[model samples]
Target: MQDAAEPPPLRSRRDLVKELSLGMVAFGADARNLTSQGNLTPAQTRRLLPAGLVAAIGGELVASMAYLAMGRWAYASAALVRQLVEVEYLAWAVTNDPDDAWEWLKSDRQTRLQRWQPGKIRQRSDGRFPNSDYHAHCEAGGHPVPEPAMNILDHRDQWVELSLYEAAVHGTATWHYLVQAVGDAPVTAAERHHRLIDEAHNVWRRTETLDRGFLSPANGSDA
Candidate 1:
């Protein structure tokens, strides 16, 4: 018999996107089942928080996937900011008194209280404040924190740790991707595509792990 032919190399960008999509679908089904099992009523505001967060995270992942597929790498990174926010919210729910967390969520003033003050504090005209510090909150809860691509908050040289999400949200450094060049070096379309795909895969994997942890029996979910 003739030897079997070698299989073609998998396309990293396409395969990763497909895999991420599948993971989102599975998570959605599991989330729905968990919500149904709880039989949560509108009045059960505390219990509703987890379900709502789960849905929100899933939606954020979908948005990220869409952006990645469309070659909007910066916007895709921006979409992940919500995932990080939701994960921290989940950590709060699992580690603290659910009632207290729920109360904080409801209060605009309380939620706006700044948890981190770096350097000289400047008052905001918009009256917005930074939320909980991501690393501290996750660490306090004994939950795994997703590895940050950049430390935009505490770094001495802000530009040294500029994150894609920050760039996309603020329109700073977005020209790097828009012009297909970084600093003095040119980034080919293929290189940029693969790089963002790898980054997205990492984010998805970490976020999924956090999601499962929140839904695990020890965290109080039936999942």
Candidate 2:
């Protein structure tokens, strides 16, 4: 049973902006540091980071816009998945079910999200969503959502989380490239990004309880 004291789901654009902003800032700072270690001058490093940061920002913006479209169209299944997946992504740091994400992306983007709804739509005045209500609404329709790492299990009876892993992988890869570009074998940028990725990985592992008693995964501890 869920505690009545549980806070409502953050369902506002402002919340999205805040979360995305923090992630972008963290990512952008790392990007800048990596670039600064390269053959490029400070000016080039600055320019490179702004561009890369824009792409990262664009990704978040596009995702938010998609959620907005989902809400407007009352595509409850799609909307809920988008929202939940995003939340889980933020928590876990990797893409959840790349196959599913691909499927959503391949669907008709322009008109598919604006379809109709037949049920009574309830609105939250304070913009808070109770966990029970969210679970009820999101899972009632057999929506093929990816198993959440902290809360759900996958087909192999494994806790499947990906977003944090993806972020860590991205950060690590970028760090390597940046290290190579900067021509520094003992640079701090590489180590810092590596540490960030390690932090993200630790979060993922803890969320899944892999180090506790969970088992049957090669990526996790033998607990």
Q: Which candidate has the highest TM-score of all?
A: 1
lDDT of each: 0.34, 0.34
> How does model 2 fare in lDDT?
0.34
Candidate 1 per-residue lDDT, tens place, 1-223, comes to: 2223422212222344443334333433443454566654543435344434443354345445445435534323433444444443333332234454355446465354552121111122122213333223233222433332222122312211112222122121111122221112222332334455456455433332122222223333223
lDDT: worst 10-residue window of model 2:
116-125
Candidate 2 residue spans exceeding 4 A from truth: 1-24, 30-171, 184-191, 199-223
In model 1, how large is the Cα lDDT of residue 51? Answer: 31
- State the lDDT of candidate 2 residue by residue for 1-223, as single tens digits: 3334432222222233233334444554655566666865554453344433432543354344334443442222223333332333222211222222223324474422432111111121133223433343244222544442213333212221122222223223333333333232233433454455445444433333223112224423222
- Each prediction's Cα RMSD? 18.2, 16.1
TM per prediction: 0.32, 0.25
